[model samples]
Target: MRVLVAPDKFAGTLTAVEAAEAIAAGWRRHAPDDELDLAPMSDGGPGFVDVLHATLGGELLVTTVEGPHGEEVPATVLHVGDVAYVESAQAIGRHLVTEGGAEFATTVGAGELLLAALGTGATTVIVGLGGSGTNDGGAGLLDALGAVADAGQLDGGPVLFAGLSSVDLAPARAKVAGVRLVAATDVDNPLTGLFGATKTYGPQKGIAEDRLYEVDGWLEQLAEATDRRTSLVKGAGAAGGLGHALLCLGAVREPGIALVAEAVGLASRARAADLVVTGEGAFDFSSRSGKVPYGVAEIAAEALRPCIAMAGQVLVGSREMRALGVENAYSLVDLVGEQRAFEDPVGSLQALGERVARQWSRE
Candidate 1:
């Protein structure tokens, strides 16, 4: 039997590679004779850089960049010639700001990453914006890019900024003027609306309900000042309005997972594989809406291969994924106790792998 182990990072517990290794270990324990293929995956989020680096063999460059809460954090950029891949989450991710107040968190560090990429003489920069910890409407990012935050009116909607203010972009602009910027995002939300960044994700970032409207207001003012239209653009609200900021900087937007999948040749891999497996930290209603599993399942479905998913947790059940042609869905929590699994992810993954291999080999 041939089993493909393709799983996303288990959030804080394990990376996709680590998870795949655990699963392979478990499968080996039960069915040593079965062939197992490891194809760790990502949805163009936090682990995007690592996934690309491992699969594509890029040069990893490490540098110091500001964190969400004004602290310095170590960040990396993946480069292949003039094209640089950056994961914004590495600098200003929710994981970095989990204990900090949302009011002060910003994407300035991400902007620094862009600057660093430009410094490397890379003409094309691909920024993965998924796990942000800021709701400042990309004000911090613009600031790092030589734009000045106007914070006009102080209504606190979307914090807008003035492009080319007292700060001169002449030097940096000369270096990056011809460079192309691509913002890769998974969400389709606009900069400001009922489903805007602050409205939908701010609460989770510790922003109070009363302050939500203010943040939205600030973003609107910033948008107006910068002469960038915030509303109506799909994905304009992604990454705490980082989408809007990039738009203002003349960046193009693309579906992050689709782009990464194409870069990594997932379609061809799925076509050649006898069986395909893909998953993430959780399989829920959201999984159907263009997550990694859905992307992998699409390719597997096209290849007419049975696609199975192994997740850390399965919340939406198997029926929701049926339309996507997912043949089976298994959760680590289902095979092992949640608490114990959380305590020892590798062990849980190994056990889960053994169970899956036993079941598949029996068939």
Candidate 2:
């Protein structure tokens, strides 16, 4: 049997690459003769470029950029000649931002990276817009790309909703002339309101519940300052409104998982495979929103292949998994307690793989 192993990052624990390798190792132990095809995935988040680099030929360039809170962090950009792939997490990711850093997490670092990519002569720039730790709606990014604004307005420096005087995109346009900017994202949250950035993702970034409204209002101000619509556009709230900024600059939005899958030729491979196994950190309702596992499972469904899902914890019920075209879903935590699952994710995931093989290898 041919088994295709694909998974997303386990969030704060293991990357998709690490998890895929571990799963393959365990599957080999259980079914040594079975053919294994490992493909790791990302949803425009932390490991976007790395996952794409796993299959797509590219030169991964490393550089230092300003962190969300002013510290310098090492970031990577994938250059496939005239096209550059930049993942926002490398600059202002959740892992690099502390609780306090979230309060003032700026996209300046990400902006610098984008500016540098512009300088590399890349005609097409693809930015993975997820796993952010900012609430400033890409003000810092605009500033870094030559937009004229108050320094405080660009630095997550407590510029209130009413304080932002203006935003000029002319300079930004002049800098990125003839370049196509694509904002890669999973979610389609609008820029403001209940389904928007602050209400949906602010708490995760350390914003006090009471202050969510205020932070959201600031983003509204940002939209007004730039003469852009606050709501209605999908993905405008992604990466703390970085999506809005990219859209403001004429960047087109694309579903991240599908884009990566196309880059990796996942559909053809899945069609040729007998079985598909995809997983993530948590398999919940959110997975339906164009996440890696859901996308992979859809490919399997289209190919008439049985797809199984594995996760650290399966929050969604079996019915939901079935609806997503997943034949079976398993959780590492259910097999080996939470402590063991977190303490040794690789081992637990490996065990899950072995268990999955046992349940399906002979079928």
lDDT of 2 at 225: 80
Q: After aligning candidate 2 to the native by TM-score, how far in Å is the CA of 91 from where it should be? A: 0.5
Measured against the true structure, the TM-scores of the candidates, in listed sequence, are 0.91, 0.96
Instruction: Evaluate model 1: give its lDDT.
Output: 0.77
Please give the TM-score that candidate 1 achieves against the real structure.
Answer: 0.91
lDDT of 1 by residue, 1-363 (tens): 776677778887899888888988988998887777777777667888988888888799999998876689999999987789989999878888755366667788888988888777788999988878777767677777776333332112133332323223244344457889988988888887689888988887878888888777766655565544544488778888888777767788988878888888877777777788777778877876567888788888887888988888988655676976688888988888799779999999888878877777644
Lowest-sum lDDT 10-residue window in model 1 = 153-162
Candidate 1 residue-wise lDDT at 127: 90
Q: Model 2, 1-363: lDDT tens per residue?
A: 899998999997899999899899988888999898989998899899999888787888888999888899999889987999999989988877788556578888988889877777899999998999887788778878888764236666334335676777899878788999999999999988899888999899888898888778778778778756734489989998888878888889999999888888889889878999999999887888889988999988888999999999999787887888888889999999999999999999999999989988963
Local error of candidate 1 at 126, Å?
0.8
